[model samples]
Target: MILHRVAKENYNLLYSIGLTGYGVGMVLVPLFAEFLRQAYGWRGGLLIISALMANIIPVGMAIKFESHKNSRQRNGFQSVPSSPQGCNEGTESNSSTSQDTKGDSSDEIGVVRTIANSLRQSDFYMDPVFNVVFGVTFAYNMVWSGWHSFLVPHALQRGISVRNTIIITFAAAIGNTFSRVAAGFLTNSLVKPVTLFLFATILNIAAILCDVYFDNYYAMLVTTCISAMSIGGRSVLNQLVVRDRASPEKFDVAYAVDQLSVGFGLFLGGYLCGMIADHFSSYDATFKLLACIDVIVLLLIVLVRYRPKSNPA
Candidate 1:
């Protein structure tokens, strides 16, 4: 929200950089969890993590910048008539009355009515463009979440030691970081996110398909790093996919809907992967499933590009 407001049209770069915080957290949490586990045990680790999570309340409260409408209302003196003192007094009285009415209207609306009104304003459910972007988010999260969850485990199953598997995970995170930063520049200039995503999808599908054929650790490492870049690239592009179509003022709606897709998709994808793992004798089958999910994402995003919107109703 703050990024959109601050960057306006230059949102892609800053937003993508901001998103690297997640990738950084992914890298940090495993180290933190491992250290905390050895030192504090699982129960104590959970308690500490919960305490850390509580900081979000204060962090969220810190973003108390003025809203667009509030800024305009507060700075509306530019439109004042320069005629006379009486006219100026009248304008001041009317402005005061309007501000008071705003407060009174909010009080009269009640919480439920206010929420309903906010929903009507958001148009999250009704906007067809947003619906497609939302679907893309959901689909991509399904594959990406499953991929992240399984990467280390699958590497372990391939006879890589637990310590070595962590290296592979680290490599993936590095790729993620690199790709996100690169995406910031790319989105601002030469490449359309859709084209970048398509390329990433192809690489991702190929990496998964060829995983079984890797002859050694280096082969697996290279594949994983490159594949991770694609994963990371998609992560950055996902929100930009929505950003390109919506105005900055509508960013909250876009962010909310996009995140709603992410949560649901992550849940559903992880569940499906769990079911697949339970059914199959090998984890390789789950990679195939992830590939198929990416195919669905590809189709959906292609639709996003080509789908007509002559009548947005």
Candidate 2:
């Protein structure tokens, strides 16, 4: 529980780090396609992805940083109440009893009740804001999966050279990394997520316009910049939403459940995007359609009247 203690400042720094890492990898995947095309040819693109699979090293390092003794110490201190001079030793026991009295049970129950009770007791999933966040994240992931699956192939078909495409991809990655770092700092400093979200929407709109109206290398590069901005912003915001929703006691489980959306989103996104790509005469049509979906979702997020709800578990 202490491990999840989030000062606004610390949250900013860590989220920035996460965004930077995600940007670097996302950027590399697209740019590296050129190398795969040149060194091994188009069909071997999947083989080049083994390099990303090797990214476990850096991920392991990040995990180690979070799990370090110094970090753990801070986390531990945050989880436990500070010692007070006049505190009773049995205070914790009494407090637990008091809480139990609110929803005290007489005896052990059946398996179904146990499971239901556990769900009822959890502080994560019982909120409307989290529900909307899940929806937004699901839409974002779907757009991403569809874009990546067909972006490069579509660009190549549209007279974009693999080398130039790679350059655009690299620039986007670099831009995304910097944006993430900036977002981290800003999140700590700012209170209004809506402002940041609005900015991201603008960027998303610009990127989609670039894709729809122009197919040149320069246009693609600019689109990549917009893509980075939108995605990097969304990534950090999602974490903040999850963090703000749960107390330290249930933070870990809440975060875990929130993160499950990513896996589900990616799986669903990939399958749907592939189907669209397979059926369309041109992948550009699919990209444009996805862009429209992004616009609609963005508008919904902007217009929605959502506030975080209480989870009294």
Could you give me the TM-score of model 1 versus the true structure? 0.73
The runs of at least 3 residues in candidate 1 whose Cα sits more than 4 Å from the true structure, single-residue gaps closed, are 28-64, 67-129, 213-216, 308-313
Quantify all predictions' global Cα lDDT against the true fold. 0.80, 0.69
Off by over 4 Å in 2: 1-9, 25-110, 124-126, 303-305, 310-313
Root-mean-square deviation of Cα positions for candidate 2 versus the true structure, in angstroms: 8.7
Worst 10 residues of 2 by lDDT: 1-10
Q: Candidate 1: lDDT over CA atoms?
A: 0.80
Best by lDDT: 1
For residues 1-313, what per-residue lDDT tens digits would candidate 2 score against the true structure?
Answer: 2224534347656766755878787756556787888889887877667766788788655642355657668556555767878777688777987668754453444556988987876653465455576666677777767766776777787888888877776776777788778776776776555457657766786787777688677777788777867776767766665566566556777677667877887788778767777787677777777787688668656643255465465
Best by TM-score: 1
Cα error, residue 285 of model 2, in Å, equals: 1.6
Candidate 1 C-alpha lDDT tens digits along 1-313: 6666656466678878888887788799878988999999999999999899999889978876777777778656345666765567767787997788698767877877978887775645445655777888998999888888888878887888887887888888899888998888898888877777777887888887777566467778888898789889899988777777655567677788789889999999998987898899667888889888888887888877776334444
Which 10 residues in a row give candidate 1 its minimum summed lDDT?
Answer: 304-313
Cα lDDT, model 1, residue 41: 99
